[model samples]
Target chain A: MAQQHLEPTDPTAGAPPKLSTAVEQGGPPTGDALAGYLRAQATEFLRALRLHRETGTASSVEESVDAARALRRSARRISGSLHTFRPLLDADWSEEMRPELAWLSGTLGLEHACEARLDRLLLALHRLSGSTPFPAQSLTSDSAGSGPPAPVTPERGNLTVGAAKAGALLERQLTLARTRAHSTALQALGSSRFHAVADKVAVLASEVPLTPAAPTTDLRALAAAAEDRLLAAAAALPLVTAGHPYNAEALVHGLSPDPAPHPQDGPWHQVRLLLRLHRYAREVLYGGGAPVDVRLLAAGQALNRHRDASEAAAAAASAARTPRIAPATAYALGVLHADQRHEVEAARFAFQQAWQKQTVGTP
Target chain B: MAQQHLEPTDPTAGAPPKLSTAVEQGGPPTGDALAGYLRAQATEFLRALRLHRETGTASSVEESVDAARALRRSARRISGSLHTFRPLLDADWSEEMRPELAWLSGTLGLEHACEARLDRLLLALHRLSGSTPFPAQSLTSDSAGSGPPAPVTPERGNLTVGAAKAGALLERQLTLARTRAHSTALQALGSSRFHAVADKVAVLASEVPLTPAAPTTDLRALAAAAEDRLLAAAAALPLVTAGHPYNAEALVHGLSPDPAPHPQDGPWHQVRLLLRLHRYAREVLYGGGAPVDVRLLAAGQALNRHRDASEAAAAAASAARTPRIAPATAYALGVLHADQRHEVEAARFAFQQAWQKQTVGTP
Candidate 1:
């Protein structure tokens, strides 16, 4: 049955396509196009799941990582598309499948997130403490003749006594966490719950249950609404503070002892969610084959950085809370936390630049 | 006349060596010990000043930079010692010489400070944006066979589009400022005021004018008072906040738009000044020939870093205020600002660690 649906000349393709065409041109609607979009995404997800399972033991670590990443991406797109275009899909099936897909995507993503966060913090520690020559000599006319200008070695930083200890502490804590996360992810992949999700996706690859009202729904309008939601959330962000080189208030707020997520981060996270839905809606409207929009890609990338930095800061903060640690270690962790927060601000600034430059409907 | 004082067995050394010995011992009054200490510091200053002048054009940039550093160090030591030991010296002479030494030190140090600051900010930007692999793979037993685990390439940071531009802006501004400082230092060195200061230092190399009460003054009590001042200032600092991994209040306080120096910073700065005086008093008590105290040196270095980080943060904030700049650039500068502020906190943490470990009068 899946092979039959995969054929180019399937009977469902004969219906007047409403979702994939311009909204202004009115035509007789059918559920075929929406079903086709969902089926294609589901098929890709199933393929990725198969590859991920295959690579678990047989392939190099990079290949395995890639497979997991692909699976997560496909799952996210399927889940997000279902969310933004929910009215046209069968209410119970779509609602049930959405959370499963979300769980799968999030579980699969934890290892990568942990790895990326550790990379960010260690790199920051090295740069902060390492001996790098000043690059400012380029401004001097005599710089060319002087070989390379001598490094401006400040009297005291030649040996940041705490840096090595701090790095070790961070490595020990984060590596332990990553190992635990890795095992959890592996267990999840081999579990009955995962098999159940895979089984559903396989069924979805050939059949998409749709509401009776699906045939008449205007997907363009729903997609436009997703874009509008993203825009509104972004507009509400503290853009002025983001533009300012230093947002002391945000920094102070981040320092609160409360273990909950930062309040200021909520709006940006909301924008990131809305953006994914908007991007996935576009994919559905274009029958999942349109050339990727460069601006949307840039904006999406920026938001992704925002999320990574926010998570990394949280990790640093957690590491700092380790009891009875050396004051030097705590100090290094503090610096690391601040570094990631700065990165958060930078990512927001990048998003503002990319999002503002975007023209609606151009893609 | 200066040659007589340069001799080891000069008339001043023949008196009961009161100031240079343990403060608990009672001894007959004499101004010779204090006079000898001042002359030795002055002689070193003169030598450094001469080296700085000679190295201005004939030496490599490194030599020139080193000469300036040496000159500034000597000038600072002399100026600080004079301030702390004011009662033993001719009031008029000490008062007049202190400001001249400060001016010379400030002018000479400006270029290097700018270079170090630029280095700090640029390094921070690169670390925040650069692609480095995750260091967490060490935790896994299988990591050795993976030919170095692949960099946990987070989807969006591969191209931090703003980093390059932000680095360029910082370089341009800081390099220009350094050049201006270099020229200003050179001009000041050649000015009549500097020449007058130099002539006075040269005369000081031969003779130090002493007050009538110098012979009776207890140098030990005065030096102890300087140490007391340093300890008092340190006690007033927010050590608890410094020890915490995240100092949100300090970070927020730093973000005030007011151009005045941060209020929290003022106490640290005061402590730095007191630390210097305390250190120089020890130098005087030892007749400037004692082995360096490792703990005191460590504490001093930490305070120096505190000063540098505070100034670097200020510079980043100033650059962010550049009118009509791109939001991305401002964001980068903002990140740089936060990075430096974290450094300031880290320095304070280091200072607390080092200072708390000191046993008074042990050195």
Candidate 2:
């Protein structure tokens, strides 16, 4: 069978020695190997969870953020692996763990997401407003000066008038949102639900429940299936739109007043989800000690940027809709919104380039 | 008739005294009034043409740009008026003058367009690249320093690497295009064809070639027809798409390798053309000395920005396609292209706002 080609003939040469030993002595690359991989991930998640709790108020903010990030990363890997390798594990146990893991990841991630978005938007606003010297003041002063009057382009002058005000409004709104998210994250971390999840992860660190059929199941085929799903999801994205450096039509969808997630973002997010599963499945196949795939890392970073930029644009759009704002303020928000959307396009372009490079290099 | 309502009941009150005198004494507001209007426009064109020639090398670059702009403006008004009120003018003469006038306007405007695009793109690049402090140097120095290390976001660090190089490439390409356009304008000005057009305008300053039926044609009905066309075209625009602060789909059309004008831009250019005709036709209706309509002027300014930004984005996309440049440079160009599209969206938003205000105020 084609799947047999993926099996390691010299077992130690492919998977880590521990997993190879488990496969050889345990009779097959089945639930035994899968459980070993799951146990290792669970142990790592427990370590991160402990580090997160131990950091407490004594640690610097950066250290706390780092701990939370580490905790979330482990949770994501565990959850994603469970999802992709479900057939090899106890279905009810794995299914029950997935949502708890997801909740923990999402709860821990909100503050960081908010902070990154604010940073992205503030940077964009500074860049956009910085170049256009407010011409109103310059024009008036030029009229009063003894030197030959400078030529003022009326169009550039008018567009930049509200940039400062717009920046202030955005800073205020995003900062407030970030504070709220921070509190929410803190609350969630201390909740009984978080404790329950931590308790389950502690148990998982010692024991992994697996199905009886898992011992004979072909791990390679399942990993391949995970990769296939990721590829299919990616292929379905509006890559043609993403390939364009400027996507004006994408911006139109962003302008809608509905507060729900943007429809255009759904497919990209799905691809991101699938990509994580594929990455984690590969981790299991390699027995969790494989050298990093630089191309996959780059693609992940690009997708993360795509997500950040998309959210930031939506935030800017929401801020622009504030009641009774000055026209200049609204105009500035509009410009800022466009700037974030450009970042979205830029991120998508970066992803396309990185992905294309990977395909060319690998194939 | 519905057309009669557009006609002046008290001619002396609606039109300038000179046109009313021509209408009253010459029997009907026919070829005589139309010819008088044409003759006045021709006189302005002749004056502008003379000033353009007289300014020569002694003029400041600003003065030269101003003179060229003046010459183009008069040429556009004359050509547009000829198009709108064709029935009142000699068909053969009008048809021949129109293209020559268009040629003069386009040739003279090329250098200005290039310069404006360069200014726009350079400003955008400067803004985009200015915010993120170069992390590479900071990162190394931080490791050496005793102070706590700053958190460096990986995504922002990677995307900005090629910005300066991209800016330099754009500057070189646009500057070269501008120099070529400047020389082209100079060559066109000195050509025999320009002299022929100038001589024709000199003749037109004294007498306009009127069709035999011009004497009885209703000027009001013709101007109204021009307005109708403008209104219909405006109504046909995808205002909902334009209304959005960000339009991603619009950006897709921009990314096509085909160098022809973007399909999305065609409708906008058509509207701009019709707007000019309507504006000039109104100028004729008011006998040329009417106060400027602020709303029309605002809408025109917005459309001009829309055109400028759309073209600048195209220029950036073209620059990005230059062979085998660094990935960083391509990324920077992509960001720049997206920035210009944002500017395009902003301009569309501005037009929507101005046009909406006009409708509300007038109604």
Candidate 3:
């Protein structure tokens, strides 16, 4: 019952459990255990925020408004919390996180407003049904199809003889939403964690009409495949001998990207937070007046990359089993050049560990 | 069960029930029946827009974000639906019933945000209580007493992860709320809603002391007394001669002395809507970053005015019982003066209605 302070000597003191082990075995990121914790927490916050907007039991007129504020506020907190990693970010990367997150929060506000309206309509239907001396569906159908344009009329409910209200130009708001899209897309370009995935997914997200292409699959499966690939890539990144994602800060700072958020040090934790924001904003604008199936598009692209990775993983697995292509053979043949030359000891160790696991179950 | 259409022959027909009838009857407002029906439906659309914030929830992270967006879309639609009142506002006021309401939908949006935030916090509290290895009271205590420092260590439950967000300005927001306060002095100087009744309520409200002069009776009883007074004033407004709450719009529109919601024409719906908004905004801003006790404030204010108005109403009632104060008592003396004022017939009718209602029972 005590408010225990787990500042240092905690399970998360050094690094997160799964990721730390993955890195120790030489197949995933290591060292920034604190960063990982921060990232995970950010993700968790975003997830919990959804409950407010997603739960049912039709919100009251007052609640609808409150719900929208809650969504915006939680998002702001999550995005702000991401800023804690500024010292950890290399350079320009940390600077771009806030604006993107802010934009994302703004988009969330819009989205919350939408769902609340639908719920309100449902409530209205319930009320109208009760007041009318008729079945609910009859009144609904009558309102929707047969009677005057009910949606456009204002004096139709009890307890709502509200004063006149001004109407905003939807097209203006829509345009504003669209203008922000490119900013999100550009942010994805510099992100090693999500860009690679988003890029590959974007390809698959498109139409395959009468043209010769792989037959389209249902979204649910596509989404699952995409997730599988992303996680796999994440697991494999530390093992890859490229050492590329590490130098991300150098290239970004040298280039002095136009969308820089912080000038000196920051925008660290913001990178991942902003990506989520990018995802959030894109979804809101697309769902509005525009009919864009962004989710499927991302899924398709992920599937393609997933297929490629699976093939490589399979080949590597088969070769590992052949005595002729074992480590001794690879060392003699000099095919382990990457391990020796690029200092890919961690990755090599990972493969050896996998083989050991295959022979003797993990301790 | 049939969806009724407007009877073509009766499009502009039907003896419109008085305004108070709408409140008493509770189905829809009585008016140009068609206009009233349409306006009420539009109001539903607006109310629903605010509720969509609930859809922001999804079991998964992305799903939740998507849900949030869905809610915002609903809000936008709800706001857009108010445009139908534009033409109505432009209609001739030769047959104007009361002050036209304005800026109501925007007010609703503001209210929706407040409600969403409160509910989100409440839900988080619920989740924290339900989620763990210990007593809820401890968490509640910690939740209140812990210091994360402004904008730095924002915690949601026991999980405190620094995200570097930019929402440190909640206190600043609270200050902004103060700026929007509908101070009694301002209302008294400008609005003509119920100055005489409000004058009495003002004495009571002021007694709470910007600095607390002294302790008083129970807040609940005080609030009740205030509410009763407002109810009486609400009843008397229509009947009291020379009561110009109806035509004070000229000043609100820069033509007269009062600051009503502008114009003595069209629909008076937005007026009540905006009044509710002022109440809501005040509630959220002043009531401890929450909306607690706002309704009580309104009720108390109403009760105070109700008490002030009842004195006149009682005298009127006594005259009817005794059949004495014909054209001589303060009752008839005021009535004679009222008979020569603007809207004499309307005032007389309202008085008779109030008298008839009092005969049966006081509101």
Candidate 4:
């Protein structure tokens, strides 16, 4: 029922003569629909790519952030669509394009990630430094209405010199690092690998690689297969236990010696990706005509969160290792490290719980 | 230089000699030393367990948190030591016990994560609900000292009815979930699974199953080998890229064709664990006489952060999926999810940067 509710519903069902309605309703995906979808995504990708090239070098950070975000989204849409509809397209061509698309996305994501970290760390440090230990007013207030106010707990100068120094170190290093990454991304974009991919995609709008007179294919099977693969992968993963979930040896010990080998944590992350594609496929094909699976959407969304948290914690650890810095700075870094690590743990626990619920009773 | 600095340094080089120092100066691991280390960890593990049993059921949440923290730490130490010193024990027995420990840790971690999420979500909502759109003072007043003050940006009421309902739903569900998990953990601690583990560990402290006349082995070599395995595994992992890093197919494509294959994300995490064990081994064998690999420590520490972030993001996502709730609450949940996801991205970027630096010129 949850899955059905989440499926795309055709709000315009049985509407009088609309071009979009004819292709989307009560039928498998035809070559025309696949081609149309690919073209739209390709066009959007190029548009974003061009905008990025134009504004990526701008002095304004916000501009670059916006450009990068747009580029990533469009690129993702193009890539996802290509994979989902590949059965109807030239397999070799689709395969060739996937890697290039991936490289572009990775390059952009790297810079954006750095910029985001810098902003987060800086904001946190600023708040920490700005906070004062005690209020200016005396503890013994003579206000009639307010009963002897609870003892104003003094803010014990929480921001140590080490903390401030650590904050400064983070700012300096993260800023430099982000700038470097951004430039690297820009360079990559300008490289032949990127240009070749871009040029290919630019031409794809007018000429999609659909097979000649391809029959309509039921996308539901593809989507189900994707889901099944993800489920199987998850089942094989060493289930999270009470001890250190990150401990590899313990996980290795738990691995089933079945022919279908259980993958490591990395592949599990891949499962998250497949889950997303499956959800997107459902959305694109069903397009409000069919009910979506909420559980799948939820699972995909949760996996995204898991991946994000895992990466962030790694970044924070890097930040913590600012090196040869003052004791104050080191202390601050430690605090940051601890905070980030806690967040990582929280995310893992949440995923396990969510995944367990999602998989229950689904043979 | 930071890595070098983090390496272990001998503290008592010129100090008076102790009986323990005789066996630790550059030789293979002796059975007695292995026995001693295992015993110490077992003692710590049991002590923590008793404390947990005593305090876990307390009315005060803080007490339970503290006890759980202690139990987790001791359990981790025991588990780590076992993995590092497995050769000194019966292989089958060590393998059998590892899973039970993992189960215990995972259970406790679940409760802790839920509690943390509930606290975080509630605090965020409080802050959001507390903020007003505008200042109370007259905007027309032109104070001489203040002089052309920058206009204050209005805080648009971002909290919709859907957001509030979502927050409440999260609070209620997360709170209930945490309580249920806490009780479950407590129950588990008293369960047969737990008792069996405890009884096994108790027997382990007194009698270690070391190989007959096992020659003293160079622990450094063992540690290095461990690190190498981790690195190899990391190398095999399809490097997390921008495009479809979440996609399972892309990741699988990156898998090596060799029989002794390395995993991607999973191996990187394993590297963190091996690094920790190596550091601990150094601490135990050298007794502050040998310096630690600062780079290794830093790398491990960063990995820990990565793991934490990954887990936390998953938790935040679970929180966001407060189903069948108010639309306003749903909106709030969405906002929370986005913010947390951004944090996750930031962390991943940081880790990549750190890892690149940490692994320069080393295959």
Top-lDDT structure, candidate number: 2
DockQ of each: 0.02, 0.03, 0.01, 0.01
Candidate 2 residue lDDT tens string, A1-363: 332323434444544454433434433345566677777767777777777777867878887888888889879988987888888888888888999999989988888887787777666655554433333222221111122222433233322434445556666777788899888888988899988988888887787777877866767678778888888888887777766544444444332224444676777778777878887776665554334668788888888877887888778666654544443344445556656766666677777767777751110
* Residue-level lDDT tens digits of model 4 in A263-316: 334665777777666655654554424344466566666566555544544444
User: Cα RMSD (Å) per model?
Assistant: 22.7, 19.9, 32.8, 25.6
lDDT of 4 by residue, B125-220 (tens): 443333321221222211111212334221122122323444555556677888899789878987998899989878866776666643354344
Q: Which scores better on TM-score, 2 or 4?
A: 2
Candidate 1: misplaced stretches above 4 Å? A1-31, A131-159, B1-363
Best by TM-score: 2
In model 1, how large is the Cα lDDT of residue A119? Answer: 79
Q: What RMSD does model 1 have? A: 22.7
Candidate 2: segments with Cα more than 4 A from true spot = A1-197, A200-363, B1-29, B131-161, B289-291, B357-363
State the lDDT of candidate 1 residue by residue for A36-55, as single tens digits: 66777777787777887888
Each model's lDDT comes to: 0.65, 0.66, 0.27, 0.51
How high is the DockQ of candidate 4? 0.01
lDDT of 2 by residue, B194-260 (tens): 9989888888878788877787776767877888888888878888777654454344433223444
